[model samples]
Target: MVDRLEQSKALASDVRLTILTWLKTPALHFPHQVTGDPAEIGVCVTLLADTLRISQPTVSRHLEVLRRAGFLRVRRIGRWSFFARDEITLSDYAEWLRDTL
Candidate 1:
């Protein structure tokens, strides 16, 4: 199970929230990817970094936080890493918030 506090902390950042929003609709927010489908395998860290105008390492750090919080699903394609929203966990978290709050 995902730790509620950790998940809350992950969502506390504006940048992290934006990243989640972008991942929610990657096709609209991101361009076509060659290696993997944006909606399937997820968006590349480099692409996210370019779009966010931040360093790749910085993006990776944010992604790591989300991943730890169970908000992200990661895929490794050769030398690259991709990230997408964990829909089930997201939905569960939303339901949890609705019930708890």
Candidate 2:
């Protein structure tokens, strides 16, 4: 779909890919992560901010863009909203990108 291409374009940046990579290895990139269960519980924006050395608001903005473009998903637990890559959508998108391009 055209929308998928647009979303792919949005994610073409290396920073976005780095973000995904960090999410894939939360414990390595981010300290204070529990010994187990970052993937299930998702990641906090503050941890992302500290790890990536980016401003909190800037990280939030990138996350918002990723969410809007369908590469990321959010889960709200009580007051905090955690984030993770949307593997289903991302997998399909990868296949689509390969097929299309």
Clashing pairs in 1: none
lDDT of 2 at 58: 87
For candidate 1, give the lDDT of residue 82.
94
Score residue 90 of candidate 2 by CA lDDT: 81
Q: Over the stretch 31-53, how does candidate 2's per-residue lDDT look in tens digits? A: 57653356777888777887788
Candidate 1 minimal-lDDT segment of 10 residues? 28-37
User: In model 1, which runs have C-alpha deviations exceeding 4 angstroms?
Assistant: none
Q: By TM-score, how accurate is candidate 1?
A: 0.95
Model 1: residue 3 alpha-carbon error in angstroms = 0.8
lDDT of 2 at 87: 87
C-alpha root-mean-square deviation, each candidate: 0.9, 2.3
